[model samples]
Target: MSEARADIYARITNEIVAAMEAGAGEWNMPWRHDGSSVARPVNLISRKPYRGINTLALWIAAHAKGYGDGVWATYRQWVERGAKVRRGEKAATVVFWKQIRGRIQETIDEADVFDVDDGRPRFVARGYAVFNRAQVDGYEEPDAPRLPESERVAHAESFFTALGIPVAYGASGAWYRVSEDRIYMPDFGRFAEPTGFYSTLAHECAHATGASHRLDRDFSRRFTKQAVAAEELVAELTAAMILADLGLAAHPRADHAAYLSSWLELLENDRRAIFTAASKAQAAADWMHARQRASAAQKESEAA
Candidate 1:
């Protein structure tokens, strides 16, 4: 890996490490948004949500700098929109990759690489700097209606139903039964809040996404002894991303809090661990989103 490319991974991993350290005992990671407009970090110019590591990086910057919304854009993109980034405002790092035929890993996320038909590796990592809307001027926040709790819950139910994963309730604990290819959860009534039920369900669904026939995300080779920890990190991150997209608060699962130490160790030992986890998590979330889209399309066809 070139020194330049390595810097990108180190920078993002270090920032997240610092944030996690800061929130250590409190269990408040940078990804914990207050169910405000900051759910999914989006670009001001394209109006599209950032994905994977970029989302986490922006969330860390926003949490540290106290930004209230998730909108962000490149300095040039802001200028193009007639908004000037305020003087002396530092930019956050967003990493992207370009496809290239090479054997060099180049500090890219391992999960991003694939063998083309010709058997050459694809992808080279690059970084971009972006400023959040909070650091810009001459722009106005768009008005978006917030869904009520009832509607949010209904939507959450529909989303999981669309995935078609068999979920068994009344279990003593919440977990994805990989052997049975199903998810087992405690009864919904047991959760202190309705949102908690969905949050936990989202985590299990993320785990289920790794089924052999599904995303097929395997961490054993890359993580070695830390494979389980890596998988947990992926599932946790995936659940947080999904809940944020659903416009719901992402509460930390009590069961997962214990894994914090392992996560820290995994990230500290490996510069690419977080990137690999984030990439797999993003794939899982995208899989769920695709299912939702397919189900919606099917329903519309039936109605038509």
Candidate 2:
């Protein structure tokens, strides 16, 4: 990797790691906000949502600056569209992977390297500067009408339901059963707040990412006390990601306190643990969220 690419990776990992460390016991991801979370940031010109680490980086930038919307564009992109970024407004940095010619090295066949119809190219992460529409003066914000409260709840419920998981409501302390491939929760009426229910459910859903057929989280098979703690840490981070995506408040459960010490210990032992856990947690949440749409599309295709 180029030195610049390496720096981008290091900088992103360091910032996210520090944020996660500070929020160890608090159960808050740095990107979360009090109100509706911004949807994934997208290129206003291309109409494409940012993906992977760029998604988290832009979200963190927006949350920090209190950007009210998720639309973003390069300074040139803004100019192209006859919009101007307000003077003194800072740009957010996002990285995209670019494919380039592979480097040549000794002990490898030069012929083999060029054998393909097109020479094999290696992907490197490249960073770019962009401004959110909220930072641009002339750009009018898009109308993002929210669903009604009842419909919003129904949407969240239906999204998960279509994923085809067996969820049972009861007083089982609210957890995903890896052994049985089931989720247990208190009855809807028992929870004092609906957000609390979703919070707990989101955390458990994060754990489901580690199932053997899925992300295959280590603790799913080992089940050691330490592994369990690590897994819980993953779930906590995942819950934060999900809540941020759904625009729900980051309200961790009362039992969140129990994982505080474990998290601190884990972070202390491994400086990069938080970064790893946070990235995987995002992946888990993304998997679940993406499945919601994929399931819907498949059903539509089948009906046709």
Candidate 3:
């Protein structure tokens, strides 16, 4: 990587590390946000949610700056929309991965030359500056429509049911047993708050996605402390993404603080660690969504 690219990685990683440290005492990660403006950070024009590291980066920026919404856009995009970024308002950096397009020359028998294509496209990170809606004028942040608590709970239930992951309730603790390919949780009434049940379920379900038959995202082969911490971070971030998509809040679990030190160590040691974890978490969340859609389609087909 070039010096500039390295700087981009280090800068974002440092900021995230700082955010995590700041929140460790309170047990709130950067991604745990109130479902106010929208579930996830989105472009003001494209209406598409930001994914992976960009999602966590924007969430940190929004939290630090006390932004009331998750709408974001480039300066040019804001100007094109006739919205003025307020004077002296700084921008946050979001990285985009662009593929390097070219081929390499290879010699054969010292007589012939061939241009051989690389097996896979190589991607380089580029940073872009974007301002949140709170930093702009002449545009109003839209109110996010919310479902009633009961309906939202039912929606979560239906979503998990569609995925069809087996759940064994009435357990003393919550976890996904990869050995048995099942999840165990206490009964519904045991949770202090209804949202807690769903949030914990999302976390466990994210772990289930890492099963051999699912996303196959096992980091346990290393059998080291850091590896375990990395997998936990992936599951935590994936759960945040899932809850955000469901338009629900991610309440912090009291036990999450145990992994905070390891997470900080990982991020500080390798600048790209956060990026890799975010990518894996995003992939897991995407897999869950795809499975849900496939299941829903199958059900519709059967009904028809």
Candidate 4:
């Protein structure tokens, strides 16, 4: 990298680290199927031989440039430890490069490497496909206190409108697009009950706030399950932040055990990720807060 480019990389990394420290990102250990214990995948370094360009780009943007010596020292420690595992000098709990390659290879041997006409070799990126072990049994639904029905609907409508998106009620719960204009609710009937309805909407509305139209967040494409889990952490954290700001208590959901493994693996592999994700979460939350303020101001003006 050129000196200028290197500087930019460092700056991005520093920003990411700052974000993580502020509760925008979370780091944890990988979970196992037994639900009673956790273990790092054994092939942490030997499995996957390389990193993806997008992952590297994001990492650089979030960590490299502006960090202080103290931060750099911590990062160095992670790298050194990771390197040792990669070199087969250490026994790591998390599986690395080689294991990743083996998993991919098992799915497709000798993947078509290039377009015959273009003569461009296809590049394989690092990602994971593993069993889910994390449990969501302990999570409790959001507390819906005794808010009026009209108030809940109005809140949901305003939240979605601010982001210029449509809401879709689902069977189980709701999900909003961060990259597109889609609202997903698993089963609306299930949530038809007073408390269920608002709680579900609240979750989706929180997602809408992170949409590109609203927060300009980069939660669109994540190659690995770990990366995806990391993004989820950002989303959930952002939701909690919003709920807190609105004087509402946040609730937990189930079925995150599978993601727990990836989440923990990523954290063990990259400490800087915690910082980067946290920063992005905070940015998303700030963006949503700003929109709420703007919307309220517009409403007041209209009334005037």
TM-scores, all models, native as reference: 0.52, 0.48, 0.51, 0.41
User: In candidate 1, what are the lDDT values of residues 147-178, reduced to their tens digit?
Assistant: 24453378888999999999986443467889
lDDT of each: 0.71, 0.62, 0.68, 0.41
How would you encode candidate 2's per-residue C-alpha lDDT over 1-304 as one tens digit per residue? 2355334334433443455455544333221122223457778878778888888988898768756456788999988888888899888888666555756443231223323335667555556889876666555434533223452376567756765667876332466778999887655544445666676777777777788898777853433445666777678766655654565643333334344444567667666666666567666766886788789899899999
Candidate 4 lowest-lDDT run of ten: 66-75
Clashes of each: 0, 0, 0, 46
State the weakest 10-residue window (summed lDDT) of model 1: 28-37
**Which candidate number maximizes TM-score?**
1
Model 1 ranges with Cα > 4 A deviation: 1-18, 26-152, 250-259
Candidate 3: tens digits of C-alpha lDDT, residues 1-101: 23553343344334444557666553322222234334689887888888999998998898786565678899999998888998999999887776654
If ranked by TM-score, best first, what sequence of candidates would result?
A: 1, 3, 2, 4
lDDT for model 4 comes to 0.41
Q: Report model 2's TM-score to 2 decimal places.
A: 0.48
CA lDDT of 248 in candidate 2?
62
Q: Under the 3 Å rule for N, CA and C atoms, how many clashes does model 1 have?
A: 0
Q: Which portions of model 2 miss their true places by more than 4 Å?
A: 1-152, 219-225, 250-261
Give the alpha carbon lDDT tens digit for every residue of 1-304 in model 4.
2355334334433443334343443232111111111112111123222234423432343233211111111123334433211222211111123222212223333333222334333454333322111111121222423334353545544664675457654212245554557776533333334334444454456556555556655543542546566766665555444443444433322222222333555666776665666566566656665777788898899999
Residue pairs with colliding backbones in model 2 are none
User: lDDT score, residue 48, model 1?
Assistant: 77
